[model samples]
Target chain A: MQLSTRNQLKGTIKEIKKGPVSTEVIIDVSAPAEVVASITTGSADSMGLKVGEDVTALVKASSVMIMK
Target chain B: MQLSTRNQLKGTIKEIKKGPVSTEVIIDVSAPAEVVASITTGSADSMGLKVGEDVTALVKASSVMIMK
Candidate 1:
């Protein structure tokens, strides 16, 4: 799929934590680096995300904040 | 500063590419992984982002997407 965002990281599903309305998915991009994504529970369930699955984390540059 | 987003990656500024209205900041989070952020040039100049500066890349889970 084409994405407008420029940052894309390929990683495997490390963990999945579910909340009432949101689901937290931790992706192991590398040894020391991981990307945490909070998506809707409905989206998560529909996607059938599981541990050990390879997923790409898409982050829009506009959504990224640079703090000193 | 407290942010509502959960994903925070600590990295060093590697390069800064400027556009008319937006600035693209590429950060090296790890050896192979980099996070690119696009923010307004005004905010970029006001923040004075430079190469070799330490910055945190904050991504709101809401803005993160997982593609299988």
Candidate 2:
């Protein structure tokens, strides 16, 4: 499927921290750097996410904030 | 305010495309690379954002998606 969000960073799943309703997935986007994404646990299960899997972190432009 | 979100990139505003309800903000984070952010025009005005202003783009962890 195609997404309209322009910010797409390719990475590998480095860790999955599970909670009751929320899950935090850490992605190794660059060496020594990581992107932490918090998604619904149900969504995580539905995606069948696992560590060492290749994935992309998608961020919508609308959801971003400009801090001055 | 202290934000739990971990992703924050500093950049300078390159352009602001205004729309009736929404506005698109382009930031030059790195040389020749830009990050596009869309926000409500009301919020944009309240923040008093302008072109060439130094700002930081804030992305919440929950708003991020893990795509495989």
Candidate 3:
């Protein structure tokens, strides 16, 4: 799908933490670099995200913050 | 600074959009893959973020969600 956001990292799922309302997904983007994303529990389940699976973490530029 | 977040992408500043209170920073993570992050104007100014500067996009897994 064409995403409006510019950053799209190729990653592999490394961990999944399911919460009552939200789910935490850890993705191994590159060695020693991982991406963690919190999404709704229902969305996680529906997506069937599991460890070792390839997925894309979509972040709108609006949701990203810059730090020095 | 060491962050608790897991996703950190090494990139170069590509664009900057400043608003009244917030700023939009876009980074080129890889070829054709860019990441957009929204940060406060104060923070952006304090950090002295500018184009062509090297940066790391830190994303908390909790702030990340999964997609198919």
Which model scores highest in TM-score?
A: 1
lDDT of each: 0.51, 0.48, 0.45
DockQ-based ranking: 1, 2, 3
- Misplaced by over 4 Å in model 3 are A1-32, B1-32
What ranking emerges by lDDT with the best candidate at the front? 1, 2, 3
Q: Against the true structure, whose DockQ is highest? A: 1
Question: Per-residue lDDT for B1-68 in model 3, tens only?
Answer: 44333333544344434445433334434422345455555565556555555555555534554333
Complex DockQ, candidate 2 = 0.13
Q: Per-residue error at A21 for model 1, in Å?
A: 36
lDDT digits (tens) for residues B1-68 of candidate 2: 44434434433344434445433343433322233466665666566555545555556655665544
Ranking by TM-score: 1, 3, 2
Question: What's model 3's overall lDDT?
Answer: 0.45
Best by lDDT: 1
Least accurate 10 contiguous residues by lDDT in model 3 chain A: A25-34
TM-score of each predicted structure versus truth: 0.51, 0.43, 0.46
Q: DockQ score for model 1, please?
A: 0.14
Interface RMSD of each: 17.4, 18.2, 17.1
What TM-score does candidate 1 reach?
Answer: 0.51
Model 1, position A6: C-alpha lDDT score: 41
How many clashes does each candidate structure show, in the order listed? Answer: 0, 0, 10
